[model samples]
Target chain A: MTGLRLAAVLLAVFAASFALAQGDPRRSGYREMGPALQKMQDDDAANPAMLFVQAGAAAWAEKAAAGKSCADCHGDATASMKGVAARYPAFSAEAGKPIDLEGRINLCRTTHQQAEALAPESDGLLALSAYVALQSRGQPIAPPDDARLSNLRAEGAELYKRRQGQLNLSCANCHDDHAGRKLAGATIPQGHPTGYPIYRLEWQALGSLKRRLRNCVIGMRAEPWSYDAADYLALESFLMQRAKGMAMDAPGVRP
Target chain B: MSRALAALLLLLPGAAVAQQDSMPSLTGKPGDPARGRAIVANRTVGLCLLCHGAPIPEERFQGNLAPSLAGAGSRATPDQLRLRVADAARLNPDTIMPPYYRVDGLTRVARSFQGKTILTAEQIEDVVAYLASLKD
Candidate 1:
């Protein structure tokens, strides 16, 4: 009887130790999932950038400032706006530079939509641009290679290669050189703008290409610039040009 | 230097803790071997052909990115294999694997796949069993 009690106590001690070793008492679940689970959960939504598409779809018809809807001017995106965004980041003669989707949307709103210039990083602007770009999903991106775009691309490429910040590292270090290596918890997707504005679960909202780039810089522990800054826009131009043949998946879902 | 030795010591425990060898073994086959084989070929059940190759006589269209799971039985432990079947990302952490199990806490599943998991728990158990049944 005493030996049986001792065996029972030993088994209990071993079980308790095992339970303690696998911490997070309840394991909180997928709701508060560890990063691995979170990444797994994002696969479908992230790859196709589906949430961005849905959000963009909604933003297309919804009226915004000055009581004007994007639909009020552009009509049905599928019909009227087909192949429109695929031709960006185009050379804008007026701006004398390559203008990406965000700048183009602001230009349209100011000229025809009778709306105010959307403040960079504003939800309204992101939604509007995302809505506009979703129309070009699956279209082969056709970024301009004319003199204007060429100049911007050069500048952007220069910026990407330039060593920046405390780490004195260039974007080339991780994105260009080490495209497929692991970075802590996530696979380093080859930085591409074929999908934006994306709905990222981390942000729990739709965001733009510029937002994604700024986050990358911030992740590198560097000082990031404002949304749609010229430097960032030029960098975007370079990426769109590089990933030209890949099908567009604007307004994508991302982890 | 002591720092290098300390780093090696720290890594030694992680290797021991990984338990790479103690994976669970599949109990008596829980699924029909034929059904599991068909599942591996079917898009709905296996879709394994999308990323892997098989020894089955005929069929093509297998991508070459990932290693062939043809003889996965000898490669990994069953518990670790279960984690991969549940969600490859759960095991690899950086993989692009679809979560075959609803092991990752998901709520309000994505649109196109709103009502279903990539593979049901039963399906995963069966597939693992079938894979375990395979020999080199």
Candidate 2:
């Protein structure tokens, strides 16, 4: 081959390899944690999230204002609620958009039980979210293939790449570009939403995905979206889609 | 009057630096390399090691998210370093580095950090000096 042709072929091959290297393999944040934290997540007895799960279980059976409990309509959670969490951020026909597991819980409360919606990050909300999420502990995340969700999911992907705040960073900059690297003392994880209602060491309590998302925005010195905002729902849908096929690690432990 | 003004300036931690690509020394005095080194090495204060790998041997897990701080002295002048450290967004609008000396035009700044720059004017000088000394 001519020297110019040979060089052109080699350049193309190099470019392909570089692109492959840039594509991050899908990996859960659980694998990025320390052994002690991993062990804490692994053991149900040791997991702090279990406390919330127990509370949720109690709330599930208790009669609400309308004189109906969650169990009254759904029956045994172990059988009925299995794999439900894995398919969350589902298209809510009533809301005309996607609603996450927490949203679903609140919707059930307001509509079926005639109760007020639980406040964001409240003990009651965290408890029920943890309890329901536990049922799908090891199921692979399966975002629904509803065409109605296409727009919000796309918006979410755009938000992930959009730079914001004083620091001018996008989610891709830290979670995608710098995953597996250290930022101060902590390693920047790939930031998959495999875990929700996670037990964070910094928080000393269980918190939802919305809470985690808000913390990230604050860290970037940006104004966080309000609770149950469509933007939050969009991001949650995108994260769930991005984490497709990754096992659910709800009530996860993190430092 | 000058004495009162100087005292008032002392109370304000992060006095304004010129809004330019290259800026004069923030403290109007040459920075102390030793003090600069201390700031760069500090995990919480400077947070330089969080994004840039520097010559600090004690810090094992230096970040690789941004450029290495090694040979920074040769790459840019002291004036350029000052501006980059104070407000890098002026140079690159999408830079992830936080503005160490700028205070206004930010959104939703945490309650404790409102109206406060990330670093003092003197701290910015120290950081710039430390970065300017990384010739090798």
Candidate 3:
């Protein structure tokens, strides 16, 4: 009974903050909203995810381990790559495991490119995978309609809702409960993936959507996924889909 | 924390130069680039040299985050630079640069210095003046 009351009080405080954020004048949004919205309706390249596409083009064209190219195996990405990035974080029957974009890309690198997989968080891996994610920018994120993904989504939601860290926060705590409220003197933006693989000034580099998610988890003081694995991407898929229509902010700048 | 950090950061310029007080007050004084250079070198209060590669007079412990401010007087207007310095994250929310002025709600620093300056408004203006003094 005591615990329930505490939960109720906390929920009310969080709700108060949420109520305050509605149409608050202090909430500064991205500067490129007008042009950004226009482009989202037009060229696929204009999609912020296109930064990854550009990066993908470069990675695909660069000479590889076999003195061949990803383009050599799959030419003119427009047709061959269309909708490929959409159904990612999919399950792989061969490995008897689920896989994300990076996983699928690395799988091809080993089988087709005859190359070693890039270690997670390494520049080549992130850049290459980010490039690939761009191809499916406008497509609805439909993780291969499978039982595996359903299970992963449930697990991910549990992880998001669990409280962690000295701050006693969860991913949902600030994002879902008190999103847009002032915290530690800064307004908390709605935690969304509309803009990602963004250039974070704090990090001084372009980072993947997963990297941002991991940073949030770390901020929550929970043990983050040590590897850029399939499980995490499934969670990323769930989160990003929830934030659909929010806009892809690839190559974006964030606090 | 703010008071101690401010004093410590200010002491840096004195440590870099052979003579103390040779570098005049950071504020007031028509904003000298030469003095700004020294402050940057000292990695003290102005610590501008720490993150940028200007006419670096001494050390290189500066961060690689921000671009060099050399010839910034001619490149970007003083107002633009002023806004960037006031709160770089406001301009580029992701910037690692600290706002030398404008302490609306900083909570980490000492209680005695709660509303105190992070490089006074005058000092920030002077830093702008000093930066603007450097041309071509």
Candidate 4:
């Protein structure tokens, strides 16, 4: 074959491989977790994350600075919050960007409750997030379809594929290329964000989805973005969209 | 240096380590294949078996994402293999293999590991030496 034809063929092969790498069907991290952890997630009474869920229920009722609680504005969380977590990391016209469940909770804390914004990964924030997400349990994830979210989602997709850190690993490297493969004795999951405020046995505490993202980046030997960074919000949006049809499994247990 | 001395160099904080960019070729004495073999088999260290199916039959759960390391010496030259192990990004921009030496352009590094490379210079040489010895 001529040099030009060979180059063309090589380019096509490269493009095909790249597309194949990105086109893997999504699967939940739940399926990738160990059986012992799966049992913990199935039983609310046995799950340690339930403590935060209970705390969040209390926080929902306790009055904030303006003599109002989350219960005051949205009464009967069971009725109001069902399937709510499935639609978060959404575009906020008020903020002019995508906001995750933690972002929305802080927004309400300051705007509606007249209270201070909770710190990222704080007990109060994790509890509240866990409680809210628990309500969406069994609901299929369905991130918003606003035209405004298109740009943010695109940015997120880029970040997910972009290689970073000294290790030079991207989200796709582990979650996409090696999903179901072993790494340091643990199965590398597809990394769908079907659960947040998950009860990771390794952490021994409830953590937001952003916290988990930060941990992965750190494992790659890369610097992690701070809490509420736009990059994180974009990634969260992308992950939620990836898991769009998967059942919500917040207060999830993982080893 | 003895194996104990190499272990001491890794354990000692701020041990006059060479930065990733400064050293291009493998530095220090010729790599000891025995030490390299141990590092490659170690899960917490080289993590080679995590992704590549090396010739270590004793290790379970070997991965298949990358090519097997059996008879790797005949497949590529020592320098080519060294670069590939140090940082395969130069060969394939999207490879999942972590750079064993290069340190810049990373994000979210931990407080204690700001300037440290994943594998020490000696460890990299050892791993390379071990790969070079894999005749079959």
Candidate 5:
């Protein structure tokens, strides 16, 4: 090839490789968080999310309306709950639909413990979710592969790409297209769920993945879904699947 | 068409239809650059600085997701800028930038915000005028 053609070919190859590199699906939100936030996530004692973890452990042991504690049925959390969070938003045969970890917890509560469903984002729910997710910290995210989950997962993928809100923005617009780019002085990370039940410094409290989703919808000037909405569960399934094989970083810290 | 004919055409219902069917043409009293600058920098109003960097120095934490508006006047005409701020999706089907004025085709809008534009026509004009002033 002539010199100009050869240079053009080299540029094309470089551009293709650059695009491929930028499309790394396994990129975690942890790296986008600055050093201070990283330190907060790394140290259990320093992590404010750990406070919720402790609270969750207490809730697990405390007797509820039926005089039955979670420990009574499930025994020690570390043993029984290991890797559970990584597999959630999984298809529930009982519900005959996909259910997230929070939903499953509420299911167990109302059915077996005879307790009322905890309100979404309530301290009790956050604590329990953080505690359970903390147990799966080192486990790889492995959302179930059941056929029942496929429909919801597809719906979720659509939601992730569908533009809503007056902003005419979709989750993919920022989290996918603009990941690693700065937005409002913060880096936009891929919308991964690995670090959910995270303690956000902005929130000054622990929040669930659904809460984060709701905030995004609101930020886009779109109406937000109610807590535990089917759409949220579908999105949760898609996010977890997107972060599959990445280690769980629950009870995580975020800015 | 003549200006009078076009103005008369706009008076008929649905005669204003264009490439972006839902977006209304922005035409009104001239915009004030000073007021425009304030709107763009305001966090709750224009919110331009949140995802766009501008020449404003006092606004800390200006974003870099979108192009800097430092010399936007030299880059594009005021009319072009008006359309972009009004309904950017018409220009690029996939833009993270929010439509500052269009109200239709949105989902899940809060009850109070239903049928509301993020900026008024005058505010959009003001922003466009202010942007037009930012020469390199």
Candidate 6:
């Protein structure tokens, strides 16, 4: 080929790749992890998140002061909770807003079990959420099609694009504009929320999606919203809806 | 140096402190290019390689999020380089690059990172010197 033709071909290739990075065909963070981490996530025996799941199992059976364990109301989580996590950040008419899987667990604690709410990212909370989420592993994410969620979900979509912090970056700047690109040694995943209560290698423990969101806000050098902030639920609602139909990989291992 | 000591030094007579401005040396002395290069190459500390590609061959994976550092010296003056390293937001508020020498005006910074800039004034000078040396 002539020099001009060769240049044209290279430009087309570059443009195509850039488009692919910015557009979807969405991928899970799991697809971006290294083989070792992938193996760690795949093997139930090796996944560190399972430790929290085990703890959650114990909590599920233990009766609260009101003499009701989660088991009493829900029964055998393996049967009762399957696919439940996939539909979370569900609308709660009692609270008059959406609530994440963690929030739902807390709601159950206060109302059904007559137990005190677990602190955000607390060991007990992580364990219980992880356990509940594990039941939905591999199920396709199916956000509720409720109209009450529309406004909050829109606010979340706005927040995702709005830039803030010392870095002046929006979630879309890195996760969408430059997804699949390198951020030093790390590959920037597309910021999907398929997994929750994941075992982050950096954290060396199981943590909720809210914890990850808080970390990202800090990374952007922005003030993180409080744990119970409507913004967290809004973002969660938006992310689940955005990731609708993707497989749930809760209690996931990540680096 | 300990951050506490660095903080102490900034309070001393000749620190030349300010997140804005391009004229003054942050440490009031010419930075060592060798030291600057080391900081740029460090993944956990400097994190420069996380966004900008430099001519550091030993580093297996350099970033592609920003312009290559290959001709940075040829492209910008030492003062301009210092300003960009210290606080690029002054030039472009929407830039994704963090303010390496800025400490004030940030909201709700984490406990560990609170009251701390991403890079110290001395380190900013060092990074400037290193970028200045990359003429090619």
Summed over model 5, clashes come to: 1
The sequence of per-residue lDDT tens digits that candidate 5 reaches over residues A96-210 is 7778999999999999999999999999998999999999998999988788899889999999999887676889988988888877788888878998899888889889999
List DockQ, one per candidate, in order: 0.01, 0.31, 0.02, 0.31, 0.55, 0.31
Please write out the lDDT profile of model 4 over residues B31-106, one tens digit for every residue: 8889998898987788788788888888888876678899888886666678788887666767788878877766
Please identify model 5 stretches exceeding 4 Å from their true place.
Answer: A1-25, B1-25
Native contact recovery (fnat) for each candidate is 0.00, 0.48, 0.00, 0.52, 0.71, 0.53
Candidate 6 clashing pairs, residues 3+ apart or interchain: none
Candidate number with the higher TM-score (2 or 6): 2
**Model 6: residues >4 Å from true position, as ranges?**
A1-24, B1-31, B42-45, B57-61, B79-83, B86-94, B99-125
lDDT tens string, model 6, B24-113? 688889998999999999976788898989999999789888889998999988898988888787888777777788877665565667
True contacts kept of 4: 0.52
Residue A54 lDDT (model 5): 92
Q: What is the iRMS for every candidate structure?
A: 15.2, 2.9, 13.5, 2.7, 1.3, 2.8
Which pairs, if any, clash in model 2? none
lDDT of each: 0.65, 0.86, 0.60, 0.83, 0.87, 0.86
A2 in model 4: Cα distance from truth in Å?
Answer: 63
| Clashes (candidate 4) | 8
lDDT per residue, candidate 2, B13-130, as tens digits?
A: 5444333558888779888888999998886788788888888898888888789999999999999998888888888876778888987767556665677787889888888888
Q: Candidate 2: list runs displaced more than 4 Å.
A: A1-24, B1-23, B26-28, B38-45, B55-62, B68-71, B87-95, B101-117
Interface RMSD of 3: 13.5
Off by over 4 Å in 4: A1-24, B1-25, B41-45, B53-64, B68-77, B103-121
TM-score of chain B of 4: 0.78
Which lDDT value does model 5 have at A227?
85
Root-mean-square deviation of candidate 2? 10.5
Cα error of candidate 1 at position A25, Å: 44
Query: How well does candidate 4 reproduce the true complex, by DockQ?
Result: 0.31
Q: For every model shown, what is its TM-score relative to the native structure?
A: 0.51, 0.80, 0.50, 0.80, 0.86, 0.78
